[model samples]
Target: MKKFPLLALAFCLATPAFAQSTQTTADLANTVKYRHAYQSMTKLPDWVAKATAVSVPAETLKLDGKSYLVGHLCKPHDCGDHQLDIVFSEDGKAVWGLLSRRYGKTLYQMPLGEPNTETLAALTASYHKNNPDDLAK
Candidate 1:
């Protein structure tokens, strides 16, 4: 019976490592699964695919008492003018994005409509956090 308690403690310690194994931008970028998922949610731009080739991992963002993972992608040479910040649910089941163009002045939410407060908050926060300079513009 004492061994059972030790086993439970071990499992608890290992759980976080497993959770951290969630895929990052670099891991999911080239996969058809991610592309299809995003496309199913909204129109996937041609530049988006190209941007993924230069993808980078991003810090997670917390909003409305929920946590989300942010992914950064940008046009290779023209990054200053075109960029994308994708926000994925912790489980990666849901996805949304903020596309920034013309030096981050123009913004568009994916799915072609105004987003609810939480979503707009998450996407905007993720984008600005990843591109701090854009916040000043």
Candidate 2:
């Protein structure tokens, strides 16, 4: 597909070993970059800013011509215990998308489309496992 190159660019900008990073954000999951954006309190569409929030960068991905950060997001009251898919623009200045599953628990990974429940569950487990510091909090 014509979108493949943009995906590749996202991968490269994020990391070469990104794919092998347990299919998760891993060490970079809840890093400063993610925290800064979270602290920035940006929201997508009708989504409101939660009083408590944390983001784990799953990977850098792309949509259309813009590079975006794909990650697991958690909001104490809103998202509860389940991790949700959240997308941020490359500059970390805006929320590109938020797969809150307001209709269902489905998560959209962009370019590739929505992932099945099983895959999304595994990704969430990996996210918690990879980012223990956050889990402890």
lDDT of each: 0.70, 0.51
What TM-score, over all chains together, does every model reach?
Answer: 0.52, 0.29
- Count of clashing pairs, candidate 2: 0
Give the Cα error of residue 38 in candidate 1, in Å.
20
Q: Which residue pairs of candidate 2 clash?
A: none
Give a tens-digit lDDT track for model 1, residues 39-77.
565555577854554677777777777898877777777
- After superposing candidate 1, which stretches have Cα over 4 Å from the reference? 1-43, 103-115
lDDT of 1 at 18: 83
